[model samples]
Target: MERLQGKPFPAGYNPEVEHVAFTREPLYFAHRLLIFYVVVKCAQLMGHGFLLLAGHRRYVTPTHNLTYWHRPCQQEEGSIKQPPLLFFHGISPGIWFYIPFLTRLGRGREIILLEVPHIVTQLSFEAPDRIETVQSLAEIFALHSISKCAVAGHSFGSIIAGWAATAFPQHVKQLVLIDPVCLLLCLPDVAVNFLYRSPPTNLFHRTLKDFIDPSSEITVSHALRRHFWWYQNICWLQDVSCPLVVALSSEDDIVPSTAIHYYVQRHYRMQEAVKHEKEDDAGEMTDQSNASGSGRLIYWRGIGHGQMLVSLKAQDRLIAAICKQAVESGLATRAEDIKNSGQKNLRRSRVTAA
Candidate 1:
């Protein structure tokens, strides 16, 4: 059975959690929603949209069952070597807002984007059991005939991905966490700043908070306050398997990214040391240091949470991580072809496989 004991908030988080009152957002929320809704609609009208993707099979929100959209590989299976991507999105209205990022990610492989209603819908009073969430994900995996896949998640979704990795190790081949809230969940930062903090007084900050930031919204505050359980959501690096990449944005307003960056890097180095001692051939042990691209722990400077949704450069960086296996595979095939053709290229790029 899963533990129900929740981590306590630091004294600095708030004087009293139950007594703390929430602030009202500006009236522009409705207007902003309509305009963004139009933008999503326009993005749909242009050429392709996520809604049209196949396999919507009766997605029910109340029971905590997840619905997924799969984008199959356009290329031959032999040429594409990357594991199938099982993606979980962060707190957002819907998956429509993430088309650009997902589109770039789906270039050469099967990508399954799973939808989370509890975080996005705000009306859900309880987040599903982590075990149940992974079971729901397994259903999608079975649909795609995928036994093992790389799991990638953002923010709230990262919590689910971490649970999946820890709980079902055999099924999760790799993990990529971005702006993840689950890493240092025991810390008071997210709950205190995102849900319980007072609204910004400055006009510009107020506008940014009320209009752009979902954390400033009343329902989001309620969702985190009532439904979020810190201990249940927390993901410790000690529990995870190998080939993990943690991407933290230095300017993230929600999660304490700098702390997370250091924490993850230190954990990986420690894990490498432990593995090295166990193996007779220490050379076989994986190197997960900050300098090693394999098992990378990236800290993106000047980037904010959810900025990758629009920024192609940010998406490309993440894309490189997600598609690392494919690039390596392609390079290997090129080298093989060059060798067969009798071309003498003395130098070859060294690749450390995850």
Candidate 2:
């Protein structure tokens, strides 16, 4: 915590994201009761059933490295072409809450859901390091025979989706980050909102604390306190090489959305300037980006953290962005060919490994 809390936002920091006297006092509220987890487990069963009906097959990687859900395209007509979508879930009650969101993305395209048990599924103290987790991603890619894919993640899941882009650049073509907590992590907003700062005592606050309180979930607490290295979690604009679709909520309490917008705008300017200089020097226009150079930056006017899962408009927007990136990458055109090529696609099973 002390290492993260430094003075005077580096040489140049976006004024919007400037740190605001961040302080810490862990476990302000106790974890939820065991009955709450029991309720969550029941909800997971419901979600599992819904997924089966939706044609999502479950698979576990070698040595149980990861548990994921894969849903192939049901409709292959028309000129629709895209690559598979690899997605990660953030801390929530269970997967069932997200089936509505995930099912929409599954329309006319293949989608894969990466599960994060530490966040929402169950109580566990184990949180893998970056190296081990990235290796697990490699295993996931090889198992599915995916040469390239578009990765979309929400909340803390964005951190892992980012890993695929940075660790295996050749494999990831586009990124769709929805209300990501990983960006601008150097700032104190995320730590304060998610961990340190306490909400006011009230009827709504009482309900809110049940979920966001660091000590409310043992696994989440451990992940935040024992693991969660910001250096490993933090992802900047320059770190990725793929076309990025960053969806920032208007009212995100965890991260500084306004600050991130300014920071990204600055980077966009830098990116355009660098491109222009290279073109001028080479005396040829090559891989020319937009002159305005504002990359696909979507700012949700009223959405808050994880609110897109419930809003129909937000879902459609996310689908369109994902499809656009997938088409641009042209990696999914080969998806059908790969499916026909007879790779060991996951077998449909009712009972999946947890």
Candidate 3:
């Protein structure tokens, strides 16, 4: 496992400012319609009428789940409070799965959990783009008078979080992507196309009664299409500008470990080149520099993909990273101070997890 500072590849790419055209194949329309039909049918069977109401709901007021912890004394002197954080969760049971990390990582600040609306609501995946997701989050941020905040996403959620960071660079102070599946390194072209059309048994339900809920089928369908799109359009990552931390599980079965390594090594090379350039200009040697500002890659040994959210030790590392990011971004005064605060909570959490 390795943890190091470096810059993300394709530097100077800010998704919010750049304009990129998204071209969908004509066949995709048919695929999208079929997914929409499944979603609508599921919602109907579940007896959710609100989801049936059309015209994309733009404004959302997210409930603020805040937890207070010890802040560094330096922060008490009226320094600008650090922006809050918003978390986008992966495809799983739901946001409930993230409660452990939320309580620990959210200490001394606010952490927002935004549910993928389509997962619960009978919404069509075709109607929304990454920009719309960002806007929807912006509405929630505005409700709390938060002009800027960090964003984190895990697995499937990482794609949305990355898009949000790309579309709203100024608004996102930092970005955390964990075990992202959209990198398209693990699966082949044939596999992605096949999965999109004919999903695996894990994704499909033989009977509506067998489903946990109507949204179950829709979530799986959406995942297939979303991942397929990612395989085609890989330019989004080039535009992310804020501080980034990518955590990869070596044993991940979904996203190829090679893809994660490629991403980390690319940034590592970029940072090294920059350091050399500095030395050449100064005509002297110097100590190493921290790459946390540009990007940081964390390789998790035992953890599998997004499992860090639920695991105790992995969550400890994640909280430390979040606190470290706060300091790096000037959101906090001292990395050690914030880290200590989170550590104390982590100790208490150990008892709960046991």
lDDT winner: 2
Backbone clashes in candidate 3 total 2
**Clash tally, candidates in order:** 0, 2, 2
TM-score of model 1 relative to the true fold? 0.73
lDDT of 2 by residue, 80-160 (tens): 567778888888776677788877776767778888777764776567777877888888888788887778888889999
- After superposition, the stretches of candidate 2 with alpha carbons farther than 4 Å from their true spots are 1-29, 203-208, 211-215, 283-294, 328-354
Candidate 3, residues 1-354, lDDT tens digits: the string is 123446445537656662221224222211234565575566444432321231112223333222111111123333334567777766654454555576566555555666664443234354345545656666665666767787888876787787777678667878888887555533453233333324336534533323433323554445444534554334244466667777888877566766667876686677667667877888753433233325667788976656777788887886677667667666555545666778999999998999
TM-scores, all models, native as reference: 0.73, 0.80, 0.60
lDDT for each of the candidates? 0.66, 0.74, 0.57
Sort by lDDT, top down from the best: 2, 1, 3
Candidate 1 ranges beyond 4 A from true positions = 1-64, 76-79, 121-126, 202-208, 216-219, 281-294, 325-354
Candidate 3: regions farther than 4 A off: 1-82, 120-127, 184-216, 226-228, 231-237, 275-294, 335-354
Candidate 2 accuracy as TM-score: 0.80
Worst 10 residues of 1 by lDDT: 22-31
Candidates' RMSD to native: 8.6, 9.9, 14.1
Cα-based lDDT at residue 60, candidate 3? 38
lDDT of 1 by residue, 221-286 (tens): 456655667889999987876467788888898899888988988887786666656455554545
- Select the stronger candidate by TM-score from 1 and 3: 1
Clash pairs, candidate 2, are 82-332, 83-332
